[model samples]
Target: DLHNRFKRGARSYTGTCKDEETQMVYKKGQSWLRPALRSNRVEFCRCDNGYPRCHSTPVQSLTNDCFTGNGTLYRGIQSRTESGNSCLKWNSPRLILKTYTAWKKNAHDLGLGSHNFCRNPDNDRKPWCYVLKDNLETWEYCDVPKCSTCGLRQYKESQFRIKGGFFADITSHPWQAAITTLDRRSPGKTHFLCGGILIDSCWVLSAAHCFQERYKVHEIRVVLGSTYREKKEEDEQVFEVEKYIIHEKFVSETFDNDIALLHLKPKADSLQCAQETKSVRTVCLPDAGLQLADWTECELSGYGKHEENSPFYSERLKEGHVRLYPSSRCTSRHLFNKTVTENMLCAGDTRSGGKEGNLHDACQGDSGGPLVCMKDNRMHLIGIISWGIGCGEKDVPGVYTKVINYLKWIEDKRRL
Candidate 1:
């Protein structure tokens, strides 16, 4: 049926030609050629108008042309034309080459596509491609396909752990309890230092002068999340330090850049647990543009020695509420006028009926803790415990390293 239909659907190509000298009429495929061409399925000839014609005359036309070359096959012609031209376009090759070259010149401009191609595979290694996002406005390591041959990335603000400290549940108040300790020597034993805030899983920032050359980084142990002094013995988590970074500009004589960051040897467990709680956290630095005057009331807490000669150790951490003194009042204090630079902030009342009226202020070991300000019912870090003439002295105020001054440095260090 198919073959009969194909035969019936065949087309004819008729053409005319003249015997040159005699001018006698002649047909290219008149009668005899028509039947032969139709049987073989060849349909290529010249028309009366002198134009070439190729048509399907029979079901076997394609097969006959493949064997005898009697018809002009479209597919064969296209293949021959393409092959002769070397499969090339006049301008397309140059255009494609230029685009690829441009992409190679500035892979960073390709954005995410570039990152996808050059990511580091090793968990310990750094990323190869650097990406700049608009939100952060800084170049960051790209996270993409893993490549083993990548450089290591360094961070300014690295995480460190503090050993020999117990965990305390301060979630109720959001205010971390600060502890102060007196310098006491124990026979054949290491003296327990003041309590410190765990700012990160690995690093602890504290007052520079607290530990002297005798206090080696690895020797010192950090205790996290414990409130009672005796409780620290039985129920505390501790980590040893690998190294300590004292501020380059820290002045021991005057206690200027009074901050030291401790790098822990082993990383602390970030997971939270019942007995070994991981509630310790770091406070965000204050915005530089925000004025300190906007903050009024502030609170400070610690486990420092209650009295200079007191033998009794406080079982629980103590907290004190203080107010930020005006800059004018802070500048008027003795010795503080020259010591308290603009970078430092003073918190405590010197006027009559002040919240810290006749109360002892932060002492040794309280350095590097937070002077927290309450704003919009949220606790904001305003100052770092720095120094003062004496703990809780009359007409004297607790000076803190203003967190605002370190905002840019902190952000730059923490960028991933």
Candidate 2:
């Protein structure tokens, strides 16, 4: 029987009842069994089949009867029967009443431990604590840390990060250069004109109506540093345009003062190998007060007509992304009541418009060019082209002339 009570040896007993002839067992509460028999060890006792009675006392009948005077209830029933049956097989009073009814129903549902604590209060769960509240809308649950999604602000609030491509590496100037012209002539053959950065070794800027009424500064030829105008004789340094200024209030059918500059007479032995040329150079202009807001982002670049009246040329240098509108949406309530002076700055997108293969505005020889705008990583300039209506249609936005309102007439005509 359980190894005959583990090889039973101790047995002794004297009696107050069941004396199966001196085997002297005894039952009926032997004086309430002297409080569980103070012992020479082993005790329990209840068995008339109600089961407990183990037995083996008499270390002098263990202080006898109700343990004489009760020395702390005779050492708490002889230290609960010398701790033997390991707390009587888990001292079960029915597993302590089912572990106190599961900790009193999880301390009244504040749920316990691993966060699912109780689970029902309209359960989409996620709240666990700390949430103060104020504006909160993105995906909703916000107590405040923000950005749960909706971003893209920057109209020069400048945070950048962007990185997707093809608007000519997001608007040129890692040294800047350009030539482009697949050759779809109109008057004398070689046409392509809008792009002109390269602000030094003889200046360039560009866009006084891309030299209105067609060609002049030596019938236009300049392709310095290169961006592929049929490879401009594999560019070592090609130059020509020698002189051009144009802003004497350049008007041409309300194109409102488009700027221009050019210059370049000598200096290109590739300007002493222009630092071993690759992206070409020069671009810094935007400083005096700086303004340029509305939707900001600028950058244009061109050789014009990538599609419209397509004779198929534009081999590369194309770029074109714009944004800056909002001068009361480019002045026209009768040209802003006849004064007409918002000094221009609009950009396109009259509801997803901009046609001709969508380089998106700055066409028919992209007049006077250079809008640019990088910031901190340099490349500045900031708007000059002017005039639009076709090349990105609808309410036709694409004007430009506000280079910070002509930075003191471009530093008093470039003296600085």
Candidate 3:
């Protein structure tokens, strides 16, 4: 094997360090030489006649931010802790003998033979390794992301996605729900009305304003695990709304208390409405005490129209970054004197909107979508898309139902 074929050892070159002014003569030619620089880093190398050299191609595993099945199959080369400490070599005598013991038990399966790559040999919360922090060998967790964790996603970027916002895959915002209504004009067809968030297995959160038409329960359908606005993927889960409850205090005239919940009908022969998958999972609800600083950057996603004038909703999902606005700026005066109640918060693209004037904000079809913020490396649902003066208008932020204010109400209502 290459490991045994390459003998890693210290070099013993007899060549003397040269100065820049010194002329070095070789069989091919002679030229002025520079002094050799020394590095304090320890590296593996093969020696040829007392000269250190790399003779083999480096074998690297595909990088992944998250893992599956206890991370035994994780082959990532992440060699640092969350706090930026270098991982101790798994084969280091000090680590194997003093700090770590699982290497000997599960080396082959865990890929912990000689490399210092981060792995979860013992199945802890995540892959971790021993580090020499402050001269003491202590264990610290690595920075691997959880694949199935709510509010976390594998975001992939590419060109030609969206104009105002980046094109996003559903896996990045797995909790996104497409609330549709049976089209009265076309039989067996549905139309996208508003966006929703999958808060739990059997419940979805949306805006009370979306249901103001008072459609029949059988006419509403909630589609999850989808990335396209109209197309459905093989993994998509379609559910009929069993029942819906709008806030009793919701006033459609001013869009106050604009929050609603829909109970998903269970799948046939099963009590669950959705099965957790990589592209389908529930988002974590923020606690009643959760509070983020003003201007904290958060994310919003939907298949909403690209802009106010766009007659069509986005063919694919799109995500936009926004900052939580200060309460003073999120007041009634800012939103054309519309009632900006205490239960409402505001967020929008705070950029000055240069010549392009392309600011990232929610659009026409994004109502009831999620406004999630990253906390403790996990995503927490913070707001629900309520209303906006216009899509991505300069200095005009989009208003949302402050989710934290309705946590208890949701808990009490979902139980029914």
Candidate 4:
């Protein structure tokens, strides 16, 4: 009955909201437990002090994966099982009798609000819930990462060097990823479309223009830990794309905001898409305030063409060394009068080689790959391969999507 009353969307905008359990005005960030129907079953929306809306910030967000002991107090809004199945509501008639019995017994402590949020009813490893499949009900655990394992990676030091982009090993640039599309005509054949970088286990960063054709998610795959452009290494990890996010303000004509994110689909048995290995790891996101000196050399890797006119993508991954250009020279006039927004940066080999000299730079198919600079003995992503003129042309710098500007945007979109 109380649940039904909550379902009716009751509201009280003028009263001093009090904690249903403590019978006192809610302190900042305190979750308002439910009161009986006598109080009209109206949930306290917020506290006047302005901490997020009531229970809006999950307890886990305040601390680690589990808020406190056994996570009984975890108020996260995760509504899916570890296997990506939607969780059945505690009060749903579809829940099996046995599970429903337990839920009914400890519905309050289980953190089963009027919604189907995951919770630790019996103090198992973490929160869990039941799901219905094939006309039968079963329980499954939720994806609650342990504190120690979150954003963990082995940062490898780069011995920066490149001559017209030297052939590189995946071990040296483990975060390098390839975004490929399956051929509709050939069925099993996948073509390397663009380069990407592993930012998280289930997230890959790439260029937005690569998806201008709007290929279906099922038609795309992200390949990591592979050194060869097309060959599948024994240790390589492959994942289908769950979805992609291209910036809302992206302009195809000017190539502004040329960044995109690919969400990797987890395996059926595990919530993780990419596993950490010798040749697979995530590159760190740079701090918002980070600024490398002008002329500071950075590294980029991809399976793009070796030269501007090359008909084939490189058979092996290649790494290029380029220096950051000064704000004065990195302008529209310097780049064929192209629209260089604040979201873009310029980098290229500053070496003044004669007519026969080869300059180091990103090529055609390298869009969406990482441009990382070394700091604190770790590689920090600074930019994404966006657009460039002819490959390795002296005095002509390649343009990239400046990642620092989107730090908050990336974090917010990933949360959603």
Candidate 5:
């Protein structure tokens, strides 16, 4: 392969490289590997302790890097280092199409609809939404209005309108995951301890309390792309945990900052966890500065319990809808003697009285599940079901860790 030859000191490998996953192709006109037609430069933007190891800049900040015939940076934007090679900036645009004509021509190559939207990418344009990638980069095309492509499907967030106590469709919520013990509970067995949300191909978000047992990397199992609780569906994807990162300031007493992240080990040496499919995908993290209004009706799903006193958790996946409660009403004073910091919020059926008029809520085994809400036609995870007084109480609503509050924290952890 070209990569192998390059590893052996080949100056460059030319021809074409196709992305096996997306079926997108990259071509070159030189002996060395060139950036693909619609592709941007790919580099690991490695970071440590929440800081980028390399500071990217507009190629103007780079030395000896010249502009291309079109007056743009030869390879878009790049920053030079002692290594003498300048790679494109992660924040840089892959290509710039000045007119709609240029845009239509390129979109044709990718089979993307030319009538989709403007060919120009998002830059200097703030109000108009753009396609945001999980790697903290925007796509070259300005076609997508939001993070809709992040993990979207034909089913809108309000579609199916259904998980808290019934059998979930085989692919109701693709981002849902089950974090369980990796056969450590018993010699040949494992047990579900908590729920998780897939935020990226290699990352999962959960509650820190779930890892209190200090499960070893090999002792954690993450099941995705399926809805059955115990059945191993043919489409299900299983992964081992490479590592788990618990928030450093997580407090057990109040469950403050109780979020955690799971790094998934691939299925094979060349396999990438959480492959995209009609039945598998990642959830979009709300934009950093995004603030969703309170009282917004949000949906949460899990394989928890139908009732608080259920003898066992649900045998199948379930989903429930809960509206966000204002912080004024979601304080510790409203609940059974507990601290409800700003980091946490409350949600549940605001309706009076029981059973019939009452709505569903996440219960016991649902800890660490996702409370996602629809935004601009895309699903964005807004909260994590942390805890509550009891299951679907009339006056007592369920408490959740406000996901928007921790967006920056989570981004710093995985935006490598």
Candidate 6:
């Protein structure tokens, strides 16, 4: 399904959380229906849509809390007769159906079993089987989102595009994130800490080393949808980090399996942390079996410094083109005594070399950023900027934490 989405030019992509919104924002040309309790039932209150909703209707009172309403309401009663239609609240159903085959849509829709009993296996644990004995017709789901994995592959529209040390528009690489840090003692100020990638709506993926300071979740901020470093654009969004999970196997000396996950806190209404727009989107994670050729063209982006000796980080986002290097060239021997495990991959700008060959590579402040390649025209995360000998140096390549190697680890952690 993901492969098909890539081929469709991503016209369906909407950078928004799949979760439902609680606020009742009125849709144009639609009637406003406010929730209300009326006639011994809980249902929508009709609003003319032309005017505000009326709330004068009082709730129906219960008689001895055991009056069986009309229709098929299977409420538990305090006492009952032997007509096989009523039972006490603590007792089982009057007519017990034995299998998942007995379930009816109306019974579940009325919330006889909390409206989530259909997912159980066809066994004794099935919840709605007994309730379905009343009506053995219909099957339906109430407003469950038909799909997930939205807000992927959004980009800034451009006529021309780059490999090294140039101002970048974040819309061109929307997955790129600016991980920042703030001081508790200080207010209204923060500093760019590391780079991150938006792999899920409320999750950001980055390097474990970036959190070496053990910064509290509240002190860290995740910024997205901005081209300028300090300027806040109308399209950009900011998030307060709720928590982060660092890989247990990460090694400070060798930097193997150097990865981490950031959980974004939801808004006041418990909706998603960020909304999807052209300026803000997520990158598609690569499949475990996805294999690209060694010299495949790829891109990396960040606000990292242009050179190893540069005193200041770039004030604007920048992107550089790079190519994957062969395993022989990406070994520990080539990277100044650093251990290059299978959990890591190397990429470099092999197309240029000289006193001024215009090199393109990842550098400081780019740490924990994304190394993405076009797979089926979809930006699939391939690696993370781990470390390098020096920014854009000849013959030397920047080492990245191989993202494909952590597919299982990421999946397991996400479920938690």
Off by over 4 Å in 4: 1-163, 354-357
The predicted structure with the larger TM-score, 2 or 3, is 3
Write out the backbone clash pairs for model 3.
Answer: none
The digit string of per-residue lDDT tens for model 6 on 1-416 reads 33432232112113211101112222223221212323333222222322222232222432322211121222221122223332221112432443332233433223233222222222221112222225543222111121223334544444233335566788887878899888566898888899999887798999999988899888999998888788888888899987899999999988988999999887777567766667777888888899999899888989888777879888888988889998999887898877889989999888654333358899899999999998876789999999988788888889999999888888998888
Q: What's the TM for model 5? A: 0.64
**Could you tell me the lDDT of residue 90 within candidate 1?**
12
Worst 10 residues of 4 by lDDT: 51-60
Candidate 2 Cα RMSD (Å):
33.8
Runs of candidate 6 exceeding 4 Å displacement: 1-163, 353-357
lDDT of 1 by residue, 1-416 (tens): 44543242233234454322112233444211122234545333333432223343553443321211111111111111211222111122232343222134432222111111222222223232222234321223322222111111111122121111122234322224332332346532344565454445455556666765546554576655555544553444556666666666777776677666666556444332222132344444455676656337676655554543446444555555567877776663555556667777777644454323235466555556667665444456777787776655566777887777766654444342
User: Model 2: per-residue lDDT, tens digit, 96-163?
Assistant: 33222223444223221111111111232221121113432111121211111111111221122211
- TM-scores, each model vs. reference: 0.50, 0.23, 0.65, 0.64, 0.64, 0.65
Off by over 4 Å in 2: 1-194, 197-201, 206-228, 233-301, 304-313, 316-343, 346-360, 363-383, 386-391, 407-409
Candidate 5 lDDT at 92 equals 28
The local lDDT score (0 to 100) that residue 76 gets in candidate 3 is 59
- lDDT by residue for model 5 over 212-262, one digit each (tens)? 878778878888876767878988888889888999999988999989999
Lowest lDDT block of 10, candidate 6: 12-21
How should the candidates be ordered by lDDT, best one leading? 3, 4, 6, 5, 2, 1
Judging by lDDT, tell me the better candidate of 2 and 3.
3
For model 3, how does the per-residue alpha-carbon lDDT over 1-416 read when each residue is reduced to its tens digit? 34432233222435321111111111212111111122222222333443333233222322234676556556555678899999887777777575344347545445564556687877765788888977888888887765556666666445254677888888889999999999999989999999999988799999999999999999999999898978879989999989999999999888888999999999888877877787888888997798899999999999899988999999898999999999999998898988888989999888774323378899989999999999998889999999988788888899999999899889999988
Regions more than 4 Å wrong, model 3:
1-148, 155-161, 353-357
